[model samples]
Target: MAIIKHAARQTLGQLIGANNPVVTVPDDSQRQYAWTKKEVDTYWADIQKFRLARESGKESASEYFIGPIVTITDEHVKSRSLLDGQQRLTTSTILIAVIRDILWRIGSPEARSTASNIQRDYIARKAGRREPIEYFLVLSLFDRDFFRDFIQDWNELTGKVRGVEDPKKRPSHKLIQEAYSNFESKITAELSSYSDEDSRLDWLDSLYECLIKGLVFVEIQTPTSSDANEVFETINSRGKDLSTVDLVRNFLMERSREDLEKQRVNDAWRVLLDKFDKREEIERFLRHFWVARHGDVKSHSLYATIRGDLTREFDKRPHAYTAGAFAAELESASIRYVDLIHCSTGVDEFDSALSEIKALNADALHPLLLAASEKNDYAQLQDLIEACLSYYVRWTVIGRRESTLLEENIFEVAKEFSGGAGAESILRRVCGWIPDNETFKVDFEEASIPKPSQARYLLEKVEAKLRNTEGVDELEVASSTKVHVEQIYPQQPNPELRLDEHDSWVHRLGNVTLLNGRKNQTNSNRPFPEKVSIYEESALLVSSETQVFRLWDSQKSRWRPEGIIERQADLAKTALTVWPSSSQWQ
Candidate 1:
C-alpha cells in the first residue's frame, strides 16, 4: 500500500538530491497542462488566504504550506514527479529569475552566480547542467498547452521586467510576483550595500520552499477493496470538495443511480444540455451558477466545480457554458422556482386567518434584508434564515413543493421568492445579519398555477415595508411582480386592419389596479371593449378605490402615439410606489 504522511516527516528533500535520485516519467504523462487565466486567478486567490493566515498572527510567515510535491516509485528507480503542485513551483522559478536578472542588470557581482546556480541546480535543470533534464518531471492531469503557456509567458514577462536597465512598471498579479518585482526594482534602483547573492537567493528560496513544504494535502490514496468514485465524493463533501451541481454534472455519467426524475436531474445531463452550442461555456456557466449558489464558497473543490473539470478541448467544443446555464436555468425556472412560488389555481381568497398566521416571519422579508442597516438588535436573522431553509427542506426535498406545503404557508412564499435560505442568508449576513445552519435544497419542482397564498405573502410584505416608509400608509400601498397592467387599447398595427403602433405606455404597471372580486376578473383575460364595459359597470369599484392597479382607455387605438403617451401620464405617479429610488438601480 502507498504510504500517506507529511513529506517533511519522511525526510523527502534529502532523498530527492542524495546520490542522484533516478526518476522515470510514465510514458502516458505527456498530457498537456491546461490552466487558463481564470484558473490562475482562482489559485492565486486561494494562496492569498494562506498568505493572510500567516500574516494575521495565525501562523508564522516562515511556516506556510505551499503544497504537496508527489513522487512515485517505479520498478527501477524512485522517480520524483510533481503530481499536482506545479504553478507555484514554476512561478517561484520566475521570481528567482527576475530577482537574478535585476541584480545582473545592475552589475551586482554575485547576482549571476547565485541566480544561475539555483536555476541550474534546483528550478530548471532538476539537478544541474552536468545532469540530463530527465527522471524529474512536473505535471498534472492538465493540458500540455496550458502548462507551456503558463511557464513560458511567466518566464518571458519576468525576464523582460527584470532585464530593463531602469525598471518602470510594477507587476500586478500580487503577493509573490508583485513582491519579486518590487524587490527587484528596489535593489536595482538604490541598494548598493548588500552583495550577498547566496543569502539573498536562499532567503527567497527558503521562503518559497517553506510555503511548498508547509502546504498540507489530504492524500487521496487509492484504497483497495473500495470504490474510487465513492472516495472522490467523500473527499469533496467536506466543503473541501466541489459544488453539488458540479459534482452532479461530473459524475452524471458515473451515477447510474441519481434521483433523475425528481429534480429533473437527468435533464441537466440530457435534453437541455444540447441547447448550449458550446461545451466550454456550458462548463463555465454551470460552474459559476453552482459556485455562486453556494453562499460564500470559492473553490473548484465542488465535485470538480461544475464544467471546470472538463478538458480544455471539450470546453472549447462549443456553446458549453451557454448550454449548461440555459439548461440549469430552465430546469430551475420550471422546477425549483415553481416549488418556491408554489402555484395553485385553486387558491383561497384573501382571508385574515391565513394572513395573521403567515405574518410570523415578517422579519425574514427581503425588504428587511435589502433595506435594513443591520444593527446589533437585529432579531435572530439566523433563526429566520434557518426557518427559510427549513421551509425548502420540508417542501423541496421531494419534487414539486408547489401547491403543497410551500403554498400552504405564506412563510414559504417569502423564503422561496428571495432565493430561499441560501440567497437570503448571504444577503442578510453580508448586510450584517448573523447566519444559522440549515441545509437548503438547491433544486425545485414545477408549478402549473400561481399560488395565491404565496402571492398574498409577498404582497403583504411589500405593503408592510412600503407602509413603514416615510409618509406611506398601508391603505395606499400595493404589490406585484413581473405582472404588468396592459393598455386596454391594443398597441401595434394589424396590417390588414390598417393600424398604427400604439405609442408609449402599455404593458406598464401604472395602468393597473388592485381590484376586488368580479371587477378584477371582469377586466382581466379580456379585451378593451369588455374592460371598458366592466369599468363603466363598476362605478363603485372605480370611485371607492384610491389606487388603480389596472386601467384602460380605448381612445389611443384611433389616435396618434401622443394620445397613448397622454393616457399613460397618470401611471408615472403610480410607479413611484413600487420601485424605490436607488443609486445603482431605479
Candidate 2:
C-alpha cells in the first residue's frame, strides 16, 4: 500500500510560487531534462489555444490540465523530490524564463516590474541576507548548473549570465539551450506583431497570467521517497510514455538503502548515458546486456521482466542482490559492450572479425558476443567471433533461415556462455546452427545480392582467398575507396546489345567482380573482348582472374547467362573454403 500524504489539483502558480515547497529532481532517481523542439512546439500550441479560450470567457476553459506529478514531500525542509513530470515541469519553467527575458527586453517600467515579480515569486528568490538563492525547480545533477546559469538565473541591469560550460559536451545541456531559444523565437515573433510597446506589455502580461493560473496538475505527494517511487512506477506501468531506462533507474534507486548504494547507481547510470549518448543506443545496450545474462526478452516487456526477477532475487538473497553489486556489474558490462559495438577491442583479429559481422548487420549475435567477451581469452574470443560470423553468413545471409529460431538459439547459447561455458562449447553450439557446406553452396550459387555493399563484401572475401593461395599479399579489398564492384554486364547496357534478361543476372555474385576504379559507360557495357582487355590491365587479383573470359572462342565469346551460372558454380566451391562449416575450425 502506498502512503499518500496528500493528493490535490493545483495550478502551476500554486505548485511553484512563493510559499510553495521548492521542488527538486532527485539525481539518483530521475532522468535529466529531455524535451526537444517538437514537444516544445506542441506545448506552445496548447498554450495559445488555452489563452484564446480563456480570453473568450468560456466556462469550459476554467483551467488547462497538464496531467499529474508524483513527489516526495519533505515538510521539514520545505522541499519536494519530484518523481515524475520532469519533462512538463522543466519545459514550463523554460517558458517562464523566456517570458521574463522578453519582458526585460521590452524595457518598459511595467514590463520590467512584472518580470521582477515573476522571477521572485516563481523562478527563484534569496530567502534572507545571509542565505543563498533558492530555485523553485532544481533539475538533477546532469542539468542543474546549466539550467540555472543559462535559463533560470537573470539580472535586469547586467543581463543574463555568461561563461556556462560548453553545451556541446553535454547532451542535456544542449537540449536546455535549444528549448530556451525555441520559446524565445516564438515569443519574440508574437511580440513583434504588436504595434506599440504598451500593446506588447499587455500581451506579455496576459500570456503570463494564462500560464500561471491556467496550467493545472494533480499533485500526488507521498510521505516517503519509497512511496513516491511506488506511485511513479504504478502510474507509468498503466501505459504512460515513460521509458524502460527511467523505470529501471527509479526502481534501483528505490531499492538503494544507503547513500553510497544510491551513489553507485547514479554513477553507473551517468556512465551509461554518457557512453551510449543516444536514447535508442542506451535502450539497445540495456536489452543486449539483459539478454546476455537472463535470456531473450522483448523491449516492451523488459522493465517488467527485470523488476519481477530482481524482486524475487531480493526476496531470496538480499545480500547478493545489493544495488552496488548490480551497479558494478552493469558498468563493467557497458564498457565491454561499447568495445563490442565500436569494434575497438584493441585486438586486430577480433576487430576484423567484428567488422565483418557488422557488415552482415548481425546484431542478434551481440548477446553471445557480450557474454563471450567477458570470460574468453583474446584467442578464444577471436575464434568465437569468427565462428559467429561464419554461422551468420551460412545460416542467415546465404541460407536465409527463419530468424526466430536463430535468435532463440543465440539467446540460449549466450545464457550458457554467460554461465561459464567454455569457448569450444559455445563455438560448437553456435556452429551447430550453420547450414551444411552443400546447402550453403546451393544457396550461394543462386544468390541475388541486390545490395552493392553486400556484393562487394562477398567478392572481396573471395578475392583475398585467391590472393593468399597464389603466394601473393592479400590485397585490401572493399575498405579502399578506389575499389568498385563492376558488373561484367552493365545494368543499363547500350540498347543495341539487346540484353533483355539483364535484370536477372546483373546483381548475381558471379557476374560482379571487384575492379580498381569506377565503372564508366563505355568500359562497363563493352563487348566481352573489350572488357577482357580492361580486366587484364587491373592490379587486383580478382580482376586478373577475370582473364578466364579470354579463354572462350574469339568469334562467339560474349558474357551470357550460362557463363554466369558456370562462374557462380565455381565461386560457390571457393566460398565453402572462405566461410567454412564448424568442422573446419575443429
Candidate 3:
C-alpha cells in the first residue's frame, strides 16, 4: 500500500496558506535563498505580462504555472520540510512582502485595510489576541532568524533593516536581505511613474489578484525524507534546474541522523561556499576535486559520480566516510584550492611558477597541483608547475590538440598521483604526454602566435632567462611596461623593402622580438640597414644576439626570410632548454 502518496496542483496563495497551524520550512538539508536580481526581474516580467493580457481583455483569468515544490510532512512538529523549489518559493514571498510594503505606504484607509488583509492572509497569521503572527515560510536554521526579523519588521510597519557589510560571510542572510531590498527599490521606482491613486490602486489590485489566482505550482507532499529527496533529484536532474553543489549538499545532509552532525556538515558546507564569489565556482571546484581523486568524470556525470563515491565509501567505512567527515575534508581542501588560485605559497619561486601557469589558464593541471600539494615541497611543486606549463605549450599550443585531450591527460595523471604514485612518477607521466622532439620541432617551425598578450609573455620569459640567470629564476615584469612584439619582417609587406614572400612569417615566434619603445613603430618595415640600427639600440638579448649573426654567405648582416628562419630555429632551441622534458630532470 505505498502509504497512498498524494500530490495536487495548487495556487501560490494556496500553498503559502496551506500551512494552517504548521509552517513550510526549508530544512538544513536544503540550500539557502539564492535567487538573484535577474530571477526577480523575470518574475516581474511574467506578472506584467499576465496583468496586461487580462486588463487589455486579451485573455480570461488563467493560471500561470511557476513550478513544482516537494515537501515531506513531519507529523510530530506539524511542519512540512521543503525539499525542492526553495528559490522560487522564497522569491515569491519576498515579492508579496514588497507589495504589502507598497500598500502600507499608500496610507489611505482602503489601502490600510487591504495591507492588513495581505499581512494576515499571506505573510503571517495570528491565532489569538496575545499571539504574535506566525510567518508562512520558515527558512533553514542558519537563515531563519534573519528572515523572520526582516518579515516581522515589514509587517509591523517598521523600516527595513540595513544590509550587512560582507555578504559572503553570511550568504543566506545577505541573499534574503538583498532580495527584499531589490524588490522594494524596483517597485518604488515603478510606482513613482504613475500619477494617480486610481492607477496605483489598479496596480496593487492586479498584483494581489495575480498572486492569489494566477501563479500556480504542483505541490507534492511526501511522508518521508527519502521519498521527498527522490522527487527533488528526479525533477532537477532533467535540466539546469538545481545546481550540482546543492544536490551533493542534500545528499550529505539527508544521510546524517543526529542534529550535531548535521550542524557540523552545514557549517563546513557554508565555509566552502563562502570562499567563492559565484556559486558556479563551487561547482567547478567540486569537479576538480573529484577528478583529482577519481580521474576524468564528465561534467554531466560529476554529481552522479560524487553521489556514487560517497555512497560506496559510506557503506564500506561508515565511521570514516560520514557526512561530517567528508565536509571537514572538503573544507580543508578548499583552503588549499584558494591558495592555488591566489598563488600564495609564501615561496617566491613556487608562487611565480604557479602565477605563470595561472596566466596560461592551465586549469587542467589544477588537479595535479592539488595532489602534489599533499606530499611535495616548494621546489618540487615549482618543477611540476614549470614542466606542466612547458608540456601545455608544446603539446596543446604547438602540437595543437583539442583542449579536451589535455584535460583528459591531466585527470589521468592526477588519479595516478593520488593513488600512491611518487612525484617523480607523475612528472614522467606528464612528460610522456608532451609531443616528441621531432614532432615538436616540426610544429615549432610552422607555429605563428598572433595574439599580442601571448607574444609578450613568450618574449619576456626568454629575455628573463637570457639576462637574469644567476639566482632570480622568475622575474615579475610590470604588465604596463612590457614591450610590444615587433615582426622584423613587416606584418603588412612594405613596398619599400619589397619583402612580400615572408608575409606569412609575420606572427611566427622566430619572426618576432620585443622592441624597447615606440621608436620601432616609427621604423616600421624599413630595409635591413635602417632596422638594424633600431635593433642595435635595443636591450633585448634576442635583438642583441641577432645583431651579431651573419648571413648564410657570411658576407652581409641583414633581416631576410633566411634570417627570420635561422632566428626562429635558434629561439626553438632556447625554448627546448627553457621548457625541458621530464626525462632531462631524471
Instruction: Give a tens-digit lDDT track for model 1, residues 46-123.
Output: 554654565566545524444443434333434444332334444444444555455445445555455444444433
**lDDT for every model?**
0.35, 0.82, 0.73
Per-residue lDDT of 20 in model 3: 52
Put down candidate 2 lDDT per residue, 460-561, tens digits, no spaces.
888888888888976777579888888876776667654567788888777778888775767776766777877778778776774447323466644567
Looking at model 1, which ten-residue stretch has the lowest summed lDDT?
A: 440-449
Per candidate, the number of residue pairs that clash is: 43, 0, 0
Report the number of the highest-lDDT candidate.
Answer: 2
Q: All predictions: root-mean-square deviation over Cα?
A: 21.0, 4.8, 5.7
Candidate 1 at residue 101, lDDT?
59
lDDT of 3 by residue, 1-586 (tens): 2231667787878777635534456556677667777877787788878877766654554767888888887555367678887888778888887888788789887887787777777767676869875777777765666666666434344433333334434555666777888888877887889999878888888877888778888878788878888888988899776888888888888778688878878887777767765665677788888888889998898889889889998889978669888888788777787778778878888887777777666778888898778667667766677778888888876667788888888888888888889888787777777776767777777778877667677777777777665444444453536456787766654555445555466777777788776544557655455566667776677667654233222344334666667777777776776666666655
Residue pairs clashing in model 3 are none
Ordering by TM-score: 2, 3, 1
